[model samples]
Target: MSASLEKGIHALKEQVDSTVAAFFSSCVHCGMCADACLFYTETGEPERMPINKVEPLRRIWKSEYTLLGRIGKLFGLTKKVDDKLLTEWETLVYDSCTLCGRCSMVCPVGNDIALMIRKTREGMAVAGHAPEGLIGATTRAITIGSPMGVKLPALQAQIRHVEESTGKTIPVDVEGAEYMLLLSSMEIMNFPEFIEAVSKIFDRAGVSWTISTEAFEATNSGIQIGVSDLAAELVQRIVDAAEKLKVKTVISPECGHAYMAIRWEGPNLVGKPFSFKVRHILEVLNELREQGKLEISSRETQKLTYHDPCQISRRGGVINEPRSLLDMVADNFVEMPDTGKMNWCCGAGGGVSSNERADEIRLKVFQRKKEQLDAIKPDAIVSACSNCRLNLEDALEEYNMDIPLLSLTEMLADHLAD
Candidate 1:
């Protein structure tokens, strides 16, 4: 019932569905996934390979789930997974890998390596192998309604400040609002300007948007920590709040993993399709632009480049929305070397930013991003995800780079027509 090695192995056995079986069976051992992974590419460690990271889970599946595995186990040919093996693998799973899905993108056999890693973390957590920081964050998310312990009063204070500064009212829990906005804790505590920017933009566009005091937090630490039960609980709050408010759509904030968790994973985690649709904020802004509701008075003449947050552009299928918005406002916008789906991760995704233990390795692997930035050498970097912005800013400071970070929504709001 409680977390233990037996429970972790049992959980691993349960995760071995047909897709996982096929993935493990179809691996060609070609090492293509290695080159695609930033961890492996950075350290050249064979153990950091995405496929290798899930080997413990794979061994369980081989021995317990498959007929051939069962036969092999009969002869004691299968390698047993133990605490020692898991202890050795904790660094590979938590510290090195960011679950960026680049390996999945380049898998020659179409294996969803990233998803497998997420599933593998379920077992890891059960075995008590998850990073201490992620465990604390998940605990806070369940107990305090936010990973960062941001409560409604904090949100209300921010809301009051934005209302006072902008001279606009921010609707909360308004029944039948056209769109419901969900924000990440990072947006609330670190980037309160994001709330103000969205408020001004929606007010100028004459849009009906309300914030939900009940389910305002968007980032799901449960998903990051790879626990479905906790993830579903988080998703249920959003579903309950959205259905109760009768909002037509819920707009995921400019945070990358938040968009992926709320927009893509929330429905499945909650075990049913949501009553309302979920959309990334960029998608809604683009819709408003197409509808001629969002108008810009002037363009920015700065030489800037867009940093595609892995979840926002690659995982969320929002590649063009931010680019279109940027093209409208930025006169000299340039693309990074791999600007779209193949763009490099900010190196702090998949809960790495929350885990203080990953600080050094995260900055070390950030060399790939550093190389990309050095090549373009833009005036500033613009991105949607607040998490990515924080990571990028940290890494920039680590490297002593002078480039600044900008948010797409904030930029669009700045150029709004009077």
Candidate 2:
């Protein structure tokens, strides 16, 4: 190896050492985390087990850092790290697993495997082994505020279009607004009607809400890219905007990953706790329902099944609010077998929807979810995450399945009192 290559490898080893130390220190291998893992249950392979899922990293820790490891290395008993090992680790870290934290929920030790995976990703990123889609999204987020690269000018134009369509003057950074409405770029590009829906809902509810074209996007590709610094920077934009606007609440729009970044990890990413509250759109609508501000007319008589976005429902602990809204809007709501927090992923989480190389793998991963939906025979599938919608749409198109996808905001807007 060249001197530069050696230096790079040494630096990566240091990172791996630190990350593995943190991971092993956090997990006790109690086996509870396995119960929540779908891959383990589906394949019945111990190697694919959740606790066992971290073994590749754990082996590196044991062979490099632990006292026993040094002795084993001295005796040539421990495996040496090499390019082949790195390749295998790469597949396990990126392809064989999704960063869904169902395992974290069942862990008695509160060991966040997602964090470990992210740390692993950091090391892989240093080695230039990250997925193309993740790298692209991160680069875009760093260059522009959002992963989709929707700049200030485009965002303002989209906002204008939404205002024109709704005929409602959506406030932008109005001084002392009660809420700062954060939107994801996906809605702006593919589902602009969601923007209109939110504006109409807020207008009808008489709630003071403003959108910040300056900090327009809530989508954090940093988390998707596994870069903590980039994630922190993207999160700071929202924090600064909220402080500047003096909004009491930061209402995230209908996107799962955005909600997770803002609601669950925003406080941590910002370094200190935020004084303002963060709520998902469904939560806001539920609050409006409780206040008697949101009135629903007769339900639309159509078959519908809801797909739970992993980030929002599983990670952010928001499951019932959207379903309650769906129940109020639809006459017939069919429950999928694995509904709520336990539901299967739409195979679009963790930035896989944008990955060209992983597209086939993603489609194959959704076979189980498609089976569930086909069993219900629903006319429409209601979901909150933009990525989920994109993946499901692609799957429907690929399999020639005939189910229309709708966002919760769009569905509720249909039943909103005009």
Over 152-258, each residue of candidate 2 has an lDDT whose tens digit, in order, gives 78877887998887778879879689988888888888888888888888888899988886687889877775566688888998998888888899998888888
Best by lDDT: 1
In candidate 1, residue 288 scores what lDDT? 88
TM-score each candidate.
0.98, 0.87
**TM-score of model number 2:** 0.87
> Once superposed on the true structure, which residue ranges of model 1 sit more than 4 Å away at CA?
1-3
What lDDT does each candidate get?
Answer: 0.90, 0.76
Lowest lDDT block of 10, candidate 1: 1-10
lDDT of 1 by residue, 1-418 (tens): 3459888888788788999989998999999999988888877788889999998889998898889889999999999998988888887887877888888999999998988998889888888888999999999999999999999999999999999998889999999999999999999999999999899889988899999999999998888888888999999999999999999999999888788888888888888898899999999999989899889998989899999988888777999998888887899999989779899888899999999999988998898899999998999999999998999999999999999999999989888898
The count of backbone overlaps in candidate 1 is 0
Residue pairs clashing, model 1 = none
